[model samples]
Target chain A: MARTLRSALLLAPSAVLIGIFLIGLVRLIASSVLFDGQIDLHHYVDIMNRPDYIAMLGRTLRTAALTTFFCLLLGYPTAYYVARYQGNRNILLLLIIFPWLVSIVVRSYGWVVILGPRGLVNGFLMWTGMADRPLKLMYNDFGVVMGLVHVLLPFMIIAILSVLMQISRNLEEASMSLGGHPFYSFRTVLLPLSLPGILTGVTLVYLMSTGAIVTPLLLGGLGDTMIGTEIFQEVMHFFDYPKAAALATVLLVTAMAVVLPLQFLERWLSKRLTDGAPS
Target chain B: MIQTPHIPIASIVETQNLARDNTPAEPILSIDHVTKRFDGATAVSSVCIDIMQGEFVTLLGPSGCGKSTLLRMIAGFETPTHGRILMRGEDMSHRPAYDREIGLVFQNLALFPHMNVFDNVAFGLRARGRTDGLKAKVQDMLALVGLDGFDDRRTGQISGGQRQRVALARSLVTQPDVLLLDEPLSALDLKLRRQLQTELKRIQQETGITFVFVTHDQEEALSMSDRIAVMNAGRVEQFGSAVDTYHRPATEFVARFVGETNLLRGQVQAASGGRVTLKLDNVNATVTVPAGDSSLGLGTDVAISIRPEHMTLGTGTDQPIAATVLSHSFSGATITYALDSAAGRLLAQVPFQPGGGHPLPAKASVSVGWADTAVTLIPGKPGHSQSDMEN
Candidate 1:
């Protein structure tokens, strides 16, 4: 009985903080969806009817999917190489995670100078005569995906690398002894076991890319506005909290629909891959 | 004769021999003047051995003597730096392990954890490109190893002994020419090891395949092998049947290693065919030796080997050996008495009578005797034998 009290006491501070934050969020959401002494569905219906909102949502989903796909494709080779090499794993991980220490806003601003019309990329292209004029590279979908991939690829590689490292090298040798070459060994053994790790990375990249705000605000132009950037504008620019909160709720539900089932799939795959292990 | 294509067992054996001598009747596998050096330091030096087909040879030695390395070389897991490895008279010093068709059961067994027993057995068959009848063959091999109906069970779910049988089935299912077992039973307890030893011998008899087993335990090697190759310092000190190795050891190392032995340092007074007469500091004895090195002349230094069981306690003095009883131990059926003699402390095992052994009163006058045939001439200084076969 006393231990239970002590355990509850240890959890008191965190529980209190979470409770207060959740209450405030709920009130905020409630106010945005309800107004004038009557529950109104007008804001949500307007968001669905608007062409701009629909275009932004479509753009956000497509860009996030493409970004996550590229991250997995490029990250698998890097992770495999790191796991196979004998030395300097700590140094390599430190280098890859260094960007995470800097704030996302600061990272967005740094990319601004790189992908802007007169930035280093354009300057290099002009100096090398690769282009006759400054390229319209900034404020585009390409710029948005480039920045998001650079920020999120470490999660994919590190996740997959850790899983691959734990797999026994003996499995591969067994395959070879049983008449498999290196390529088929990777295909039959290493790839299947690593699927969970890859899926985990996929969900992370997709989730962060879907709801990403600051990168789009700084790097993407007016023509490339995503649903997350639109929601940010609705809350900050317009004092109409009801429409803004309604839009935020819609975005949250949309993101959850995509992320929840994929996360479930990742967990299911993880269990299947590890089930064959000798407990 | 070609109507049905049936051949008798004798003709099959004869046909195999007729094709075998295409290049010459070289050993099925030969370790020729092999020296293994690791990072410029010698691990095994100037060692050579030959294994014939269907021979149960054991690479027996203490730890770090390069017996494992020699076995690994035979498995093609290691390469000999300065010698040739000939398989069926062809040079295979640098062949990859997988191409050798030699199954190696690692000290850890190295069974695939992700595979069940049946799939594990089928691993080598699939690798060898056999598609059909693999399931039947796997079941047959499992039955041979007494693991039938364990097909779907995971390798992790079985007992240690059963896992050993599964590993055996897996390796044998490949039909490897030579099966290299590196202390396969060392992982089991004593009772299990004894049980598996008989099972392994039975399997060898049934399969008629060459089994080159590596072990540090002398008793395991001696009890299981048809021929034991006692090794030290990466070289074979002696190779012969267990009885020949124990009763007629060729080297001092072999004498000390194979069983309990009382080594008595002496100088050779006379040397002849299969016999050497030696004079020690306090006693003179004639010893018979296996025919190998007869180079030692009169006055050359040598040692006499007397096994503990060979020494008999008696009161009569017809050229009797004398020693003081230091301590004695009761071993149920037999009593092992430790005696301090001119050479050193020696152990003598005497059958315990119905009541008790004749307790030669402590520090009392006691005489010991052994026929000349019981003494073996070794080529080193005296060393005590504290080994026991009780357990």
Candidate 2:
């Protein structure tokens, strides 16, 4: 049918791109399992058994989780302000998105200039006689998390804002008319209605931070190397392709393990939220 | 007494009597000189209205006439730029919506989409922290609105009419001193609108809650309100009973907005006592109508409103004006005839008899006459010339 042909044509470009990526993924999996052209599970077993790799994975997950939490804490209020602002909302939204327009690598380096030992914050503290010495602000887990949250804050804010804009102002008024205080009305009405956006922002920031490389490599200390930096060092510095591929496979599986459950929760929550709503 | 020839002063006395019979000593809610301005443009001018307890008072006007703004001020959703709102003699103008204890059923119903009917109805009770017998009270309110078993369904799962009932039940469950409805029935179909109008009136009576409803439909206001406040251009043009508003409109805008009427331009020829005889423009006829306002001096220009039903059409010699039939239309209950007369193109509604065959043919000569008591002198210059007053 013509309809079938048109749909096929529409899907061809994205399908071809995904197919190429899938072929690369298959090669990566094969390399992870192959040692000297013989099929083996040693590489994957070696990764699972290694204490350092285990620590790296744990550190990566913890950093990602912290990044997601901080992003939500900071983004929610900003998004709420922008969504409910009485003036031109576009100006506020533009400010939120301005950082995203810059390259993430450049922005991460900008954080280095600000958070360095001799940087603006330390300089201010020292100049004000608040600190006797320059405080350790970078080359640690704290630095890596700060950078990741900065890079991902806009995503979280934008996600929450889109959903907040959809909720009618009338619902809040109705709650207030029924004897709810402003804060009570927000918690009982606005917060619950915007849950889908929160979930989306949380999942997106978590997934992106888990696989982040540049920020962790630049900002973290030598012992604070995450799974992404570990995989990068294996493949590029040591030229250990098999180990790198195995680590990548581990990272993919771990990310999926976190996201799959979240995807399910998102589905169930969306069904409950929009079950009988008018289209 | 000055010889007031044909003024029906008795009807005015009857209206006052009826108002006195039902009106309570103290009004439950009073909007005293309230004015709302948004960014320098006035939405509601200095308007005052006293709503009695257990009375259904409608703020009726066209869109942008400040009826909704006035209602919002009464509901405490919007603070008035000027003036005080008194609830039981207490100044509540500066109070928040929650502290006002006023329930408002919004134009869109504003039902919580996230909550089921039971939770939605019980929300007010829970918000007020009065959890004592909350479930039973919600159930009772639902039953009052005839939504007994629909508590389990989400707001989106129900029909539009059912959602309207849910909104009503939710607001009434809080047992607020006054309930404000902002054109809640405007979304439904005509048949459903009529059914809900009756339902809303019944609920208002059963709860004995003062209702300040805002709507733009004149007929809806006329049918559902105990007293209707006809608004225009950010001001209350007239606030009175439906019969008083319809029979004796206070302004030219009220005369035209409240119902369909033929506005005939005229000038006062003779003024005596509480009546004035106005000689109509273009037509060689003089009509004596009640001088409701004492400002009518001799030779003053005025416009008189004549309801279509009041204008009688016949071939009798006593009929004052001669006209030709322009066109006609058949509604189920009445046959409306358009007559092209020397006065202007006037509309006349006649009761349709089942046995009466057909309307007068176009271009047929006819005679038009109306009782002098039926003419209401509009207290302003005629808005348009007599020829263009077809609407």
Candidate 3:
């Protein structure tokens, strides 16, 4: 009884905060179903049939997946190097997390300066005679992805590095002694052991990218608008609370549709990898 | 003498050829003045040794004595800073670990936690691209290690002893020419360690593979190794068979490291008649030095090492050093008595047959004597008043 009381006391503040938000959400959902005091499902039906909303959902998923892929591709080597570096490892880790010291909004805007049409990359290309004119570097999917990957790559690197550091160097030595080349040893031993960390990184990046608003807004143009933008406009610009609520519900459902199965697949694959297929 | 070296076409080819006819030659692995340094600190100094084929050679020492470094150098996990390592007469000093074709059971076992017993055992064979009879080979290895039914169990699900067997089976399944063990049984309990020691010996003989084991435990080295390399401070103090290492340790470090010993600091009193008598510093006694030791000379300060078991009760023809029993304990088979003489304290191990003639208790006076051949004299620094030494 004392333990229960203590737990309840410890949880009371967060529970109260969540309760307030949940009641507000319930009210929003009720309003989403009622059209001026009469029960209706018009907003949800309209969202389902709307081609623009469906396309937005597809584009968001694609952008998130691409961002996750690029982050993993770039982060793995950096993580491996940082983890294996014998000297000054703390300095390298600090450098990996240095970008986070600045505000996220400021960092996103900083990318605008580097990736604009008159940015450093375009200037270098033209000066080096690589291009006749400035390239379309910003206000596109590329700019949005580059910015988001910059924001999220550290999550992946740190996750993988923590796991990589824990992996015994002897395992790789044993593999090499058993006639495995370096690459083969990495694939069989290091990669499989680091799967849990990879899964954590992928899930975190995927979910964060799916719900991302700042980078896409600051760097993306009209066609690159994601669900967050539409929901934002519905609430702030149009004062359409019901539509915003319904759109948020749809986005939440879509994220669950993708993330839940991925989590399950990772769990199943890890079991087979570690448990030898239950043979 | 440096033996002639031979290079097999490939380990796989050799494995196939040896399947029909099996014969091994001298010094399968040789370390010629090998040295290793880490971050400017010498981990293993210039060391030279020859490991014969099918011999169980153990590098035994305390921690940081460079035994593990020496073993790693042999296993090709480390590159020697100086000298050369040759396997079957071919220079393997700079070869990558994979090309060395030597099996290693790591100190932590290093069994793949992600792999089951079968997969772990089959790893080397598959890495070598020999999968035709891999299943049967894995099963055979598991059976040899006495873990036949544990094929499907992951490494984490097994006991420490079982993990050790898996590691052994994994290494032995590949049938490498040499198997290097880095204290593979150090993690087990005393009973399990003893059991696995016998099992390891049996497996080594059955496979006829060169075994190089590393450990700090003296008894394990004494019991398991065909030849023991007693190491101290990055140097091999002595390398010989267990009996030679025990009976005739070359240095004071080996004498103290390999087993319990009573050290007597003395000086050479006479060197004639093919016998040298050392006048002990504190006690009124003289000890005849072992024959054929050219190091001892007249008036030379020396430290004499005698195993505790070599000291016997009762006065003999030689001078009996009177000692008082300080404490004694019976360990079922033997009784160890800690005695304090006029010089210093020393230990004596005696057989414990119930109701034997000897019944000396604590604080009782006794005289202990040992044969001249039982003592080994090593060079020592002078000016110590007490003759007896204990470590």
Judged by lDDT, which candidate is best? 2
Candidate 2 TM-score over all chains jointly: 0.88
**Per-candidate chain B TM:** 0.88, 0.89, 0.88
Instruction: Calculate DockQ per candidate and list them.
Output: 0.23, 0.40, 0.54
| Tens-digit lDDT track of model 3 for A18-75 | 9999998788778789887898999999988989898888888898999999999999
Q: Rate the local accuracy (lDDT) of all candidates.
A: 0.77, 0.85, 0.83
lDDT score of residue A176 within candidate 1: 55
TM-score (second chain) of model 2: 0.89
Here the TM-score of candidate 3's chain B is: 0.88
- Top of the candidates by DockQ: 3
Ranking by TM-score: 2, 3, 1
The number of clashing residue pairs in each candidate reads: 3, 0, 1
In candidate 2, what are the lDDT values of residues B1-391, reduced to their tens digit?
0111222324433543454466557777887888899999999888888877667899989999999888888877899999999997789999999887789899999999988898888888778877776667788888889999997898889999999999999998877878999999998999999999999988876666778889999999999999998888788888889888898877778888899988788899998878998898999888777887556878888988889989898976577778899999999999899999899899999888998877889998998878778878875576632111100
Residue pairs clashing, model 2: none
Comparing 1 and 2 on lDDT, the stronger one: 2
- Interface RMSD of every predicted model, in angstroms: 5.1, 5.3, 2.7
- Model 1 residue runs over 4 Å out of place are A1-154, A161-166, A209-279, B1-26, B32-47, B69-96, B281-292, B297-301, B314-321, B353-357, B365-369, B380-391
